[model samples]
Target: MNKFPNKIFDIVQEDLMAVEKELYSIIQSPVNLVNDISVHLVQAGGKRLRPALYLLCARGGNPDPSSELLPMAVAIELIHMATLVHDDVIDNADTRRGRPTANARWGNHSSVLTGDYLWAKAFSAIATGAKQNMLKILTDVISNMCEGEIIQLQEAFNAEQDEADYRLRVAQKTADFIAASCELGALTGGMDNRDVMQVREYGYAIGMAFQITDDILDITASAEQLGKPVGNDLRQGIVTLPAIYALKTSTHREELRRIIVNQNMSNDDVRRGLEILYETDAVEYSYTQVSKYLQHARNSLPITLNGPVREALLSIADFVGLRKY
Candidate 1:
């Protein structure tokens, strides 16, 4: 963000800070354990990308949207936080953003309940003032996220998973929520239906690109860079785009399939799988997909949008397609 679009955030840094302050205030709980656990998770920190994207889109439609849109922005973040908490539990993931996850620090029962608490709070915060349409978007996205997770679990270590399958999971698990964030932000900012739809698709494109880039990084990046084990997705038996591509194009296709289906993958299996990915140019192929989505994101931006906000959106799209972390 510092390199890509810090200036935009710099202009609204106070808004983001206010979000953090307000978030901390919301996480306060009567139960000591609840407070401690939720606070610990919040303090672990995140990209805050959902809220940031929400704010940017809100600002694009209304210059002074921060005061009015604060609740929705915070709700978006809360939902994101809730989803991550649940995801860590589902994946049994130990770390997120280089720190122990809530599921790692607390037991699954505690973490799951805490995630439910967050989700309830998120809806409670928005249910009072937000429009019916906005409420529907959040509810739908939450359902989609759950469905996506279920699909991923069912397809674990599925070497037969194709590009279509990969895309379906990406759309449900990641892209749809991102699109909703932008749309909700635009609605909060007072954009018309047409413009809102444009930005919605824009967010969808970037969201897809972002997840693909993440999956690419999973295989190609280091644990230190990722703040978790490299190849974590593969290690979890989650097949992504690069692996799916390699399974088709690699000369060692059968070997790659063998590695993917192997429930107990050794270090050698992971290494060999990566070799097939690189050897088949699967990484580069995945990059091409990122580029395509990014281009669509740019194309989908509202034509009437001009000036810094538009530029900020473009910069973010670029960052999503090219980020190292």
Candidate 2:
């Protein structure tokens, strides 16, 4: 995949290739329908950022986290892919990564089953001699993710959903999962409990920044850059950080709120909403939030974290802060 280049990826390029191999193996099955759908899911590209984060954290303390820890990275990525697939169904998304979504090509029923299978495979991989402590991390993230999704459903299209409300959903839906990936990686890397917690905190900050950046890009980025249409989240009635800021501060609050709350967004409505967002400091405010969290992620690292691993973590923060796609 053609993700933005970074120094951190070079550090784990070989390990990342191994992860891709294992992921391909897991997507295979006896059923032709399952196999075809799984292949499509694989073809729908992703940068595999979650697994790369895991491998980097594992390398932080350990001298060498060998093939033994490879499965953990694969498992983490599987869970991530599962969520994206299921989310497409929920959103009725036609395309992802510039290609037809699984639910679009096949059907929602098959797509949902494939997503369920991915979740099962994730747990199965974790069960393969993984410690209970590691398993607990996965289970906790899953629980939090479910809670976040439920809250998102309850809050969708409600213009009253404030910054605090948006953050609550973000903490559980996205940040929590990234935290689990880091924590699990550090645990496998044989770090002490104290260090693992610190790494998890770093992941938490970066996760928030990464997700918030995604929200900003949804509005400010072009369709060519994002591989999808702009203002998609707003059209779906999912009020994002920038939109929330605009709603609270912009003079056109009533018009914006009407479009969002009514949930009947046309191309013209989307254009009008974008006009309001740009008139305010919503995008700039969102950028400030992303920068703040990235700085926090950097500060969370202990003094002892150094060498190639430390540089990698720092580079990840920079990438998250500056990436356009």
In candidate 2, residue 271 scores what lDDT? 89
Model 2 lDDT tens row, 174-205: 99899888888888878888888999999999
lDDT (0-100) at residue 215 of candidate 2? 93
> For each candidate, how many residue pairs have backbone atoms clashing (under 3 Å)?
0, 0
Q: Model 1 over residues 84-107: C-alpha lDDT tens digits?
A: 999999988998878898888888
TM-score per candidate, chains pooled: 0.95, 0.96
Give per-residue lDDT, candidate 1, residue 150. 97
Once model 2 is optimally superposed onto the true structure by TM-score, how far is the C-alpha of residue 172 displaced, in angstroms?
0.8
**lDDT: worst 10-residue window of model 2:** 60-69
Clashes in model 1: which pairs?
none
Tell me the whole-model lDDT of each prediction, alpha carbons only: 0.87, 0.87
